[model samples]
Target: MYKYNNFYKKNFIFKIIENDIRNKKYNIICTRFPPEPNGYLHIGHIKSICLNFSIAKFYKGIFFLRIDDTNPSTENIKYIKSIKKDLIWLGFKWDKNIKYSSNYFDLIYKYAIELIKKNLAYVDELNIKDIKNYRGTLLIPGKNSPYRNRSIEENLELFKKMRLGRFPEGKVSLRAKIDMQSKVIVMRDPVLYRIKFQEHHQTGKKWCIYPTYDFSHCIADAIEGITHSLCTLEFQDNRILYDWILNNISIKHHPKQYEFSKLKIEYGITSKRNINILIKNKIVSGWDDPRLLTISGLRRKGYTASSLKDFCYRIGITKQNNIIEISSLESCIRLELNKIAPRAMAVLRPLKIIIDNFPSNKKIKLLIPNHPNNKNMGYKNIYFTKEIYIDILDFSEIEKKNYKRLILGGKVRLRYSFIIKAKKIIKNKNGNITCIHCIYYKDTLGIKIDKKKRIIKGIIHWISCSYSKPALFYLYNNLFIKKNINNIDNILSFLNKKSLLIYNGFIEKNLLQLNNNNQHFQFEREGYFFFDKKYSNKNKIIFNRIISLKKKNN
Candidate 1:
């Protein structure tokens, strides 16, 4: 497991890229992140990003960003562009020489020709359905195709015609001539190339025939001179096919594939298939919706690149399948933010509290540290006044034991300001309490008993109504209501009804003067939040709670 300490971050990074001037230990360790351009990258993809790029960085070699856009029907140029952007955003820079699976079509076709020449592969005219029947099933031996016995010359001519678009899609396929009952089913004459008439985004109409990933990936790695082809565990079985393809064709470099377990975060689905289903059904707002697990989604939700890297590092890597608690990830972000995020004051679901004894328009600014324990972040002032807005949940009309907040004639600290005691309850015509009017005891009561004396049972945050700014607060909880967001239960039904709540809230005046470029802040006694980068400004800012403070690792 890669440790979370700076040392581990440094070593795991370097291990992938060890320098050797003597050339005795190892050669330039070239690695590639070959993502199929069908969907956006998710948290799981980040683990791959870290492993591949960090290895390249560690070995002083190259990390190539190769778009494995072989499937023309589903792959898109938009996804390719977005994946490149995602890598850059994740703080990874690939080697200058970029590659795409489509770029090697010429070489792949040449290799297919070589396979045909060696009598190691042949063109099979069997339609996919009949081919599957001939390929047999789990407990039976497959029968050889009728076209399997075609003369090498006839097969070559037809293969060239297949490349020249003489055949319809799937009417003919180029398959490897491996064992029919080798036990390992994939080795049983697997299809290496298929014909797709669809316009490929890249290498458009150059050839109708394209090599499958199993065939193309190994050849590409060898062509690029990759040393260690690290991939997820799902490819372990595919290693046989990859080896067969590479071994049959002599290449400059023979890369070894090593598989590790994929990352899984519970309460989140990282599957592009599932994401596509959700999107097609209009279940999510968009790819960048904060509720999603896509890179853009996480970024939109205010996840910092460094924090995400730390989370990936903390989770470690192994070959065993794991369904990590989403809370573990949240913990990493919170731990990092706690060390760097600035502190502020915000009250959501504001309950108006008017101190009648104090001057109606008075504003007293109290010095508050930007980071409670770190003065180097500097200090800002929070205004306290006669009229203030506290959280509605922080107060109860009827008191319970240890319910330290506002109630009938109860007293509590006003956080950095004079303590006030409720003197009267103001109500509406329907007997619902409209507001609670109180009197500030500036001398003998509150968080500060005097200039030197203090009484603090529970400190609650409030924003001055007289001087503070009103912000639109978006409070978000876990998107799913299910206990296991990964497996079981209907995720669609578990989608929290109250995931995103819009409220007109109050913030300290200093928040109004806040620099919009910085998206991080912790509202004292409230939660962690960031001013929305896309929709916040000085006059009226929109703040989104990244996560609340009540959330702790259990």
Candidate 2:
């Protein structure tokens, strides 16, 4: 048995497990994360993954990665592979080899036969619609099917026929003969197995009968001796049926089920159906679209595994269902990247600045710290040339109240270099300022100038036009504009049209050496960004902005 520990007493689930261990409930604690291989795992799954894995690891128990592939209609090998990859990327090592529910099909079938022999199960010939009509709602009790009273021997024969492909799909189903008048609607003789004339991904066409998730899940847990079965609160109603199946079946280990609230973020959609609609309509590129919250999407967007785990820890485990502000998650990544991400300067919507007073042929190298606070990270060399590029947003022809940036005839400090005064402006035929003429103070490099005389209170990041490389930046925002996305009938209608904005930018030429290294960068005044391996190549560089410097007020 695992020893009691108060390390995670803040979490209610841990407290329950601690009590169970204190009372000597079992020989060892075991937990499993069983994901149905229908779609790529999302941010919501990260919560359960961290909880289960942390529980087992804390108690020195066993953790299992199980695939609940009972339904083959939507399951795919690619999804299974992606699930495993996501787990591995999250730094979790499942005990023993990965388990699949399909591997226990024969044994689960035998258990079903045992229930039939014990008069606890019966095969029904009712169609899908009639079964639903008989299984009434929460306010009304369901009535038993006419076939509910079939003898055990007849049930065995019909169930055998179901296995032999004797009936077409949905013609017959095997349901447990439980209380029909029970308040828990799922306990009203829930279907245990159904006939599907579909090919299985793992078992192939060896069997036509497939067990329902409610039927196979508990049996699989009992078979593997899972000590605590953790699931989301949506399955709270199914707990009664879960225990019913385990208690009636002849299993040595009957694991208890525990429910916790699933993670729901505001302005985000976790439903696979809704995400598919977004993809089908081409609102997003694919499942790995950076705007999405899918694990792959987040990964592609440059969210680190450690940052996600930290986010899970910050949210913690709870029974109360609530929508978490998306900023809570973004804050975790922002805090993490602030310490590790290298600082670089990039100019999106570049405004040309010609330092007329500086020597035209002079190119001075300046040492810029990779991280402001992290001295061990060392420094990087950036060139200061006669002409430089600054973000257009950083310069204004006329100054506004409390604006801390460059203006015509105003002075500002060029980051890590010298102070510059905007002397003149060059405009185009449309009266739009295309460039600015400036002069740099030769003695002000890394020097504190007198604010009383210079009035240079603002510092702006800039990259040398002669030494900068052209790049593309993908700025991502919330996929949906509505805070209450759950009530959205048409996701496309409420879609944030400007969720993804592309910009042609210029970064320090030295950044080219870090390309394809999967490096994360904080672009000085710009937000955090990751080198996009999928879109970047030898000819062109691309980066996806992970998040802005701070959350914008909606």
lDDT by residue for model 1 (1-554), tens: 23334334544334433433344445567888999999988988888877777666655778898888788998888888889888888788888766898888888889999999989899998998998898887899898988887878988999989988999888999999988887777888999999998889978777677888899999988888877788888889889988888888866678878788888876778878777767887877778777788998888777888878878877766778888888887887788778888888788788889888888666666787788789888887667777888888887777787565776667777777766777788888998777888887777432335423324335677888876778898776767776456654345766777877889988776564564456788888777887776766557678777777764321
Total clashing residue pairs per candidate? Answer: 7, 0
lDDT tens per residue, model 2, 173-287: 9999998899999889999999888888899999888899999999999999999999999899999999888888878889999999988998898888898899898998888
Instruction: Tell me the spans in candidate 1 whose CA falls farther than 4 Å from its real position.
Output: 1-25, 429-431, 444-457, 482-494, 510-512, 535-540, 550-554
Against the reference, the lDDT scores of all candidates come to: 0.79, 0.89
In model 2, the runs with Cα more than 4 Å from the true position are 1-7, 452-454, 514-518, 551-554
Give candidate 1's error at residue 387 in angstroms: 1.7
| TM per prediction | 0.90, 0.95
* Residue pairs with backbone overlap in model 2: none
Native-to-model Cα distance after best TM-score fit, residue 292 in candidate 1, in Å: 1.9
**Candidate with the greatest lDDT versus the true structure:** 2
